[model samples]
Target chain A: MKPTTSDADENSPDLLLFRYVEGDLDAAQVQELEARLASDAALRDELAFWKESFAEPEAYDTAHLEKSLLVPVEPRWTGSYFGTWIFILTLTVTLFRPVPVAMETRPVLIPAPVSTPAVADVVTEARNPEEAITRSRMTRITLPFREKRLPETIEVERNVNESIIPAPIPGIKSRPPEVLSPVAQLPLTGIKVQKVKPKPKPIAVARTLSRRQGRAIMRMKEKARQQRKADQFLKGNVPYVVPLNSENF
Target chain B: MRTFLKAGLVWSGILLSFACYGQVIPLGALPMQYNPAFAGEAGGPRFNFNLGLLTASRFRHNEYNLNTSYDQFIPAIRSGVGFSAGYFTSSFPYSSSSEGYKFSVAVAPKFSLKGKYTISPSLDLTYGSSATSWNPRPGTAKPLNLSGYHLLSRAAVLINSRKWYIGYSVDIPLHNTYQYYRYRLFGRSDISPERFNSYWQFGYTFQRSSESKFSFTPQLVFLTGTDRYNRYSRNSFRYFAPEAFSLNFRYGKFIWGANNAGFHLGMQTERVRVMVSNGFGRRGLVTSDGLGSDAYTGNLSFRYMLKQSRW
Candidate 1:
């Protein structure tokens, strides 16, 4: 719908004045109309109606007064200027929202090297009764540990926010991505936070080997068992952005 | 630090006073009317330094106000002091001369309507003495030694998104002089409004960002003005009335595309300047020695402009 002047105020003086304001008109009718505004009471009343239409908006019809001001005049929510206004408001709020830029600093994930045999992709199938109960217990215990450590790991990470490394400082060279866990959290400690060492996965050799060889395999098994014990040992939950800052690499 | 800070304040005040002097002419007393909300409040005193030569773009911020420019950044209107020096070379029809070491008092105010259009009016009150030597030297004419000031007060309006603008600009002659050859007056100063000619301009900002500075503005400007200027020669006779055309280019702070009249080329920072541009008037269907030669000038400046910053 086209918004025109008189449609808003049928007796507006500003509207009346706008048309005659420009150009030289020799029309006798225009001359008579100008002369009439001075003497006629009804014309004065009508002109007063025009002036007060905007000036004394509380005295007039709300709809007509609103139309005159040319404000948020559109009615529907989905279409028209109202929609545009909503979009602008939403965009402004969204753009200015504090973006907690720390999210951009995801710790450079130097993923732990997995034992080739231990990490085989498993297919989902109906499980044996004994295995199912054990697996359910394992998941219940493991899930909480994973969820709890995430935040702690993230907080300790240093270079997680930036994606690309900055231009190499001319005098300085870059080293490969490495984790630097806290010195206090060495292997001798019972702490079980995962480390990201690039050790090859241990292969299951037959147990017929000598005691020295068995001890190596046993040590790997010993470490895995210690991890499980610590997993159960953790009492509270914390999400982590773990890196060299939090653990051994 | 205290002495440097004081100098900076004094310098900024000088530039600000000169800037307001220029703005007051066009706006008529709006720059100083204190707002009740800001009556006792003091805001953004900034200090920025630019390496004055090309290939040295390392700029330091807030040297004068102790890093106040970033956190205490002002909007449109800012108060601060700066010192700049630059050189310019002018090439006139008869000969070419190089004018160096220009100093300026700068002011910039940007006004805007929310989410729509932005208006920035800035002034540069500059004084530069000349180093000029005429070519085919005129007879008994004292060397056109223009040892005075050049003031350029400009108002610019820009759109927030559409990149369109309409501006009203007036270049007022300050405490300056020109050994204007009769022919050069028509070629130098256009007929100004209020005895100073005005140029109504329309422009489009095609390229923009931090590094671009003035390099980003590609404007189509129309210049029209007149003064009684006569170019009578033993070889040819020419008269100056009013010349008008749409000049298109990227203009830096001081220079527009090459001109000889007063415009010289001095590069401090930024691009597309009308350097003390000498030899830049394109002759219309008329000829001197029947040679349609327009001396296009390009000057390099010593004073570098700070980045086109948002205060």
Candidate 2:
């Protein structure tokens, strides 16, 4: 069927020609439209008319018009102008008057240590679970006990009538008579412990180690546990900037 | 002749006051105003809105302001982009009113140091316009109106660590249309509205242990400009949990010939923060009667975060 240009529909020749001019028609549509235009003179005239209507007009010179409108207006200083200026002048000075300048001081920067090595790494000794738990529970008390100096030796003055006896100090077993210090002869009762004298014998302090060992272990374990908790926390959270509160002008 | 020169100086000061406020905006409880490098450093895309009201002796002297900002960090490019807008309006006792509008765009790229520290250098381009209307007599016809526009460029660098941050920023006016207006008014051809302003800020955080749910931060900021110098300090405390409360105290010195102090209290959740702040200070009155009058401001801010930061 031949479609007439006067047929008013969505796909009319006029609409197609308009779309074609706007480059909105697909390739097949373009081909069909072009074939129609080639076969019909009236359609060709309509297409040409559309083209002429859509084309942009050529530019022309407007120098004379610009020249006529470019005149500069002279400012006139009248009584009202003077009055306004004086008022503005008064207002500006009154509103923004100067004040005394304060002294300027710089802020002090306090630098923190990057790392602390003494407490960074703590080691715990191997022990039974019960012992470890006990050690961990004993917080700050056990640390200072091991740090203080214990007596190295005791001098016993002999009671001639008394028999030699073992010392009563805990964790220090009785030493043989031959093992006693050369400066002192052993008396069994009312033994007076004198100042800690330097001796070649080293077993006295070692004997007391068994009693202090448990406390030392507990202190280290507690420290190690705290360090572990800190490590876990740091691993999960990374620090970021915290902004300041907003202010008014 | 002396009267004219003094008038010119006073006019410059008045305009400079507005310019200073417009350029160095402290909005939304963030450092993005002074240092663009701080944009999106909080680890996610975020939006903020704030409204403020200022009260003084007279109704005409009161001021109102609205501020909003949005920023996002793009991990793919290791950079951030931000946009901020603000409006401010105030009236003078003498039948005159002034209004200002400001908009800015900022960009910053993050550089990592040792996987624990970050250094970001940023730049911002801002456009600002202010208009003023003067009517010598109220209810009069044909009031005079004057408006001007300006372009400003800012550069800033921030050094951020796990527990500390330091930043510095400088603002330079690129183009000012008010210089021509000033010349036209006073016949002074050599006037330029170019004032150099800079900010230096440092902050530190204190947390006893990771297990502890409380943290404290103290920050100090200093502002130096051609016509003014200001120093302020802010301390903030936050409780970490599903829901938390924050308290902040602030004090500033030499803010327009007045000592200023304020406080902000807020309740926050994982994704939203709402805060109310109040500031009170004394300002030299406009009448220049050598007497100071008290000024107060109340503000509210709402901020939302798209994602939670690791901190």
Candidate 3:
């Protein structure tokens, strides 16, 4: 049926009729809708049809409806055993492959050692005895002896006069001159000469120090030992002493 | 319908071209793989499997990788385990080519915060072996065989919301020993051990969801790490060091399908500088004449969700 007003308009008579039936219109609009409904047979018929159609439907069998609307689902690849096996096999093969060895050639270089010349002034002065006695200022000799070992003896030749020989000093042990090719008498001057005992292999000795130096070295060694013991105890490597209980014992 | 067919044809052509160009390996870890907190944040029990092929510009071969994960959300806990496997071949112009394979497993647990935010932390353990066949030299009768096994580990954290995510991760080497076997003399020699190295990554992801057809994710990644060395006797070779600043940008698209299944296509570009220590303390890039190099990668991923009723 043709309507009096366009359906697109919100204020159309058709919408007003529905609102009137729903009791949503105000008093004046309801009165106007009622007057229009009374005048128009088509409006009365549309309203009656609308009321019938909008009424609640009768009971129906939902069991059949439920069965007809099921959604189709495809099986997933991950659901299969073969897919799982493929993943496992891939992981196993990738992690267990054989490793390779690397090789390369590299050059090695070795360095040479350097040499120094020996000093000659000390060797020449020891050979002249007349000059040595004139310059005798109690020179001391210090041998390089290993721990607890006796120092080797060295012999020095002298003129027959005993006073000409240097006196022995403390901590510097000196051996008596041994006569090699027994004392030779000079024909005119009546002077006696003795051969040095091959210079006693020419022992290499350093300059000497006093007896207090030896005592200082011993004290330093004792201090170092005590420090080592204290360190060991602090490091828990040695047991520390604890006071024992006593009754004025 | 004609437009749809044309788009399909174009995508197929692009895929064919990419396949011919070999694989493009992602230089850094993906957010889902590195972050535990991002697990199962999509609001369902889901399974994901992805396969990727990566090729680098400096290397002539392709690398193939496969990853799978399954996660479920419960009132009490959110947990998932992931497995990944990869095989790669690398060739140098003047040196012998090498092939390697690796397998990794990750365990991730997620904790929900305030029903909107999630925190996931994960640990990954990986093992792999590689072999290099030496080139024949004038004095050598046969090629020397060089092989090695390596173990790697990663610890990561991710904090994510429905639309954004932030994550950090550290990847380190656990075992760095290699062995060399001389075939002619039947002698074996051990190479210098590799030193501890850590590769770190900080990333942010932004997601834009679509109602029906497509979704998009844009990500920014910052990568940095210290120098790593391989020691032989008293000499050491520095292999890789982090650049002062490096960044990666990734754009990903998701095309939806029936029953929550979708195809994910992503493209990423990265520029990084690696300090490589040659013998005698010299350091530079092996791939580039300059100090840094650029890498481009593409990824295609697929996911299928089995709904509760179907399960």
Candidate 4:
């Protein structure tokens, strides 16, 4: 078998040894280098020295870096922070809040007035015949008195057709106006029937058309009038005033 | 599961605190709903995409909605054309589900006034379809399905000045297959499902000076119809530079009874604008399950302006 003497190994065996230590050599180069190493002890020693000097450093501690990446920084409770928390709290409370109960009450019915026998009817019946006859003749005949009674407990539907009259405000005093003796009758001698003239009907200022259309028509008329004036002036129909003073020119 | 959900919510809250800026884009923000004349108001071809999520405490069901639009102005004709599409789906666990899809096209022509103001009048045509499916037990009879189709036309007018804008729009249903079918099926046409809807929008911007970069805008919108009523208002503060940052407070009642009040943060650059908002309100998506239950709503929107030549 031919020795593996590539160009690089022939010029520099140390380079080949370096490649061998770094595991950069192919299988053939490795076999050649190993064979040479077995023959020369000095080459083996040089290879061992290279391996020891070029060895990679041991792994370093990364506890600080891991902490920096994983841990969260504590924030100071500034005003803005406080406000944010407060808003969050309010929102959470609102979101999870219970349904509100409506404030309502049943209507309370007032007790009807206590029932009592009518004394007037009994007195009228008990009157003497003569006095009754006189009273009957002098007074108009009236129907027997009947009182309509409301139920003791009338159930009124709350919030439906219920009238709530506010209490009258306090501190008001009423003063009746003083009546002056009727004014003396106006003297007829001075009263005269004057011929009254009918007031003229108001000028029809109300527009019959929309304000915008009316304004547009007015603008067109004004423009035509102004054009007419300009034309007249240009045709010398209007006289130019002579200057009262030379300096006024 | 409840504890985990609460924790997740708390985490989201914390993240939102860091963001500190967001804005809500109700239906009023959509050109199709508010004013079709708003299409291509930015003067360049633009695309908009939006995502909305509705979740409640008992997370058995969640509702999701998606919307996107494309629009551009043609300088030669002094007119703008816009097209928008939207889809939303909601489900009730193991029982029923409903979904809807809508597509719309709008045309608006611009007219200049006094060399400083713009008057735009637009018309929009829409085709919408909705389907609902009910699931029954294995041994029960066949499932029932209800589907409907509708066509709507909207006319809108907008007046825009340097710092002020006002618009009004009205929606009319041209055709409704559902109502006709329902009338035929049930033998009565008394229960109509569609009615005339009108919208009004007004806004004014306040700035320190013409050259200043900071501005405040207060906007109001009212939507009235025979079937529903909605009121939306927003107060926004914006700081403009190469990039613009804005903060807005919004309060509104959306269709189907979704009422919300929340804060919004937004950022806008030349080509892109992003907005996100979170609010707590009653989710009206599934009224039966969402009623009286607290809900959290989050909306994210993106606007991209494309080069005119590319379009």
Candidate 5:
């Protein structure tokens, strides 16, 4: 039989190899191509490169092709190494990090009582029983509380003669005593009393003043007291108070 | 039997680590969930629609996702533009049910590396919202609804050849906020939490055939976040650091034609950890140490594409 080199002679070596692998060449052409492939080093390398680079088209029909070709190559350095290191570092830092547990320090404020002149003016302006009650409510006394354990004794100072008394009868307009003595007095330990100007007339004589004038005087006294307290608190000199239980005493 | 035993051991270790770690937010049907650069790299169809079903083993959760993507290559700039919209719903056996929707747009510009590889860089902006329903406590008959919005920005790089591709991406949370009605014994009030989250991922894809190809992709992702709970309440200022590591595998097939169909299967495992600190804005409280949970999930999806051009 004549050697059928006619088809193989027209094609390049690469094409010839592809045709041979695809089973498109006749028997004589296949033999011729195989002989050349065996003798040619470059041709062998080219064929090997193609085989490694491309898969047969028929292989696409098989689902298992990925098992051979598509499986990801093992990385030289796996991500798990870095991940584990990070995980360890994070856990260590979070678990061992220092945290503060104590309460923060805050400034405390204590307001001083109203001045003697202001108190006298407020008392004189109260004209009737109703006016006295209203004016008393307007006088604000702020006690600064501290977040600490309280002591047995709380030091509160007062004038011994200036006692809290109910308003006199509406029609009794006599000039009452400037200072009414307290019915009972707690024992004074280190209390200090500073002498000042005399107080105004008591609630009985103040009842003769007009109600509108009493209201105006009451508002002025309240505003002055609030301004003084705010200034003292801002200066950080206000006294701090601790709540005391009567049983502790 | 030896292979089975080895696999079993590996899975057990993963589960143990995950259980001891923190909570993980699931990535439903977004390819950007793996790497943002994958946005328009395939470049086959003008419109693609996908539907997926997923199940998680940790909380006995079932989830469904529907997504639609549109991608077009602009010859003038040698770039691609992609837009994707997705909806996701998840239900847990006894805990909560959540529904969310997301929309994102990406611009990808392509460059050739040494004429042998194609490199594409992409930026994606995403907006999403989620609502969760929590079962009523002991005395209440109505469920509580919590809703939140998230804005995310992502940058990614992808390098590809005919047979293989590799990508890396970073996602940053631009804004995240959540609000819910919190009921107390005496009254009900609104609570809004401030959230910050970011993550980075690296992925590799290998293809088996030239035409009608089958591919496998594996991804490694790292996530970190600081989530502040009950931000507006006094004596309730608490913040936690959440960190997670995830491994994901995907197998997909692409059928080439005017009307193309794609099928995918995915498996994922994650370990999360949360470290909580109390009294961030108050006094006399310390940070609390906490543990996390492990989760495993599987997903199956199908995609149909309508091609408008042969590019």
Candidate 6:
């Protein structure tokens, strides 16, 4: 074996041992040495002599470094040979253990999501519209509402049709600039114009809408409360009927 | 009996990695999910032979922050080139050729003693083609493909004694990635970062290999980066994670690790699991102009490390 280009093992009996530990030997030569050393005695002595040459830091030979570590030995290394062999054997097994087998086709790959699919469905969640209207009224005095207008071709546009007075009695619109007051020029609001009311009272249609919205909100809240109770019941004491099992625990 | 055999098989797989020649082959499809923060960086031979299999595959989330590379997982295998992910099955059986050759090396040859410190430095290298592809989903708007050659390496230190396990590793061009993800969407191939950088991983490890062939290693790693010239990470030197650790396990030739960091998690299963696993990438706090560069990251890989050295 060849010594490494390092000095960590210098002066130690194993100084050159690391050289062999380094992979300086060819496969063919290692095999040849394994067979020859098992039989040849004199050659083994020569091998040991060379091996002992670098036993300490006194000498570092390149020939041994580049060549084989299995030269014939005289009296083969007896300096705890058994222990070193065991360690080497153990290391060899650890390094050479067969890796697990892999086939071409692998198992199914399952994807994991950070956010469950249910989460992205927020905007489309099941909702009680009636409850939403009631909550909106309670939360803020002002709403982010835009002006609504009835289309010219339609009359049931709740916003536009319920605004001010209707267009001049069909055709007679001959009012001068100073003739009519600003209030009188405005379109009439409500089903019929009031002759002289103190202030505009709530429209019947609006009152009806308010009532419906309130009821819807109350029902939504009640439903939510019931759902909570049902969930708790399921989790706390989930009772089950025994099925077709022969044995009982 | 199956458990023991599985353990033995994994152990043998790990041992088979030590041949001085030939290609860099992983012991099994799975190997220890390692972090430079805890592993000794001195490049010698780190053996895991006789360790049992980590039956728990490296099935991990592709969340980068939740976990480190040690927590990624290998995909389950069947035959040929077909694979199943979730409910989707894709196979490229027409050309059963490999993406490309991969080369991996781990060298940690220190057995010497330091003053009051048992120091072991190791070097690890991995470079190969990715075995998976990144498809452009609807409106993703990406062009970074994880194709072509990738290289990652580290030189690190592991100092340990009776009570504690401390480690540090300096990563070099170890994770040189040449990705081409989501190219069609962007109308151009993805570009590789021309800069080089080094990352350091420091952590505590609990290794329990005593006298048995099977052992478990749990470690917590703190990672930091320096020298912006490397340019892998856009941010300056910093560290995060009050609770980011990796649990690496070995059984025979099989090894696995799982890590969770913040909201991201990852897993790494090697050898018998044969993979370069980096999947399940979820959106993080960071936003990008494109999905390819933002979605694809380096993580949870299963690789074969082949090594040879001269004394």
**Top DockQ model:** 2
TM-score of 4: 0.43
Q: Rank the candidates by lDDT, best first.
A: 2, 4, 5, 3, 6, 1
lDDT of 1 by residue, B1-311 (tens): 95585455445433432221110010101111111111001122222221111110121110010000111114324322223344433233334344445554544443333323334444445555544454346555655543434443333222222344454444555544443332253443332222344454443443332223343333333444444332332232223332222222343332233221222233222211112222222222111222223222111212112232211
Model 5, position A238: C-alpha lDDT score = 31
DockQ of 1: 0.01
Candidate 5 fraction of reference contacts recovered: 0.00
Best by TM-score: 2
CAPRI rating of model 3: incorrect
**Candidate 5 lDDT over residue span A72-119, tens digit each:** 877555588778888998966655544434455555333334333333
Docking category of candidate 1: incorrect
Q: How close is every model to the real structure, measured as TM-score?
A: 0.27, 0.44, 0.37, 0.43, 0.34, 0.26
lDDT of 5: 0.47
Which of the predicted structures, 2 or 4, would earn the higher lDDT when compared with the native?
Answer: 2
Model 6 lDDT at residue A240 = 15
lDDT values for all models: 0.33, 0.57, 0.44, 0.56, 0.47, 0.35
- Per-residue lDDT tens digits of candidate 3, residues B96-128? 567777777666676645333457777878788
Candidate 6 chain A minimal-lDDT segment of 10 residues:
A240-249
- What is the per-residue lDDT of model 2 for residues B14-100, given as tens digits with 9 covering 90 to 100? 333322221112233544767888786766778877666665564436566778889877767777788999898877667878899
Q: In candidate 1, how many Å is residue B5 off?
A: 41
Judged by DockQ cut-offs, the docking class of candidate 4 is: incorrect
Q: Write the per-residue lDDT of candidate 6 for residues A79-174, one digit (tens) a residue.
A: 678679888988666555444443343343232222222322222113454353233323223323333232334235467466653456766876
Report the C-alpha lDDT of model 4 over A118-152, residue by residue, as the tens digit.
43322222236445333323433334443333334
List the candidate 4 regions with Cα displacement exceeding 4 Å: A1-249, B1-29, B135-142, B179-194, B227-261, B282-290, B307-311
Error of 6 at B52 (Å): 16
CAPRI-style grade of the A/B interface in model 6: incorrect
TM-score of chain A taken by itself, candidate 4: 0.26
- CA error at residue B249 for candidate 4, angstroms: 7.3
Residue A239, candidate 3: Cα error in Å is 63
Give DockQ: model 5: 0.00
Candidate 1 TM-score to native = 0.27
Tell me the spans in candidate 2 whose CA falls farther than 4 Å from its real position: A1-249, B1-28, B137-142, B179-194, B227-261, B281-294
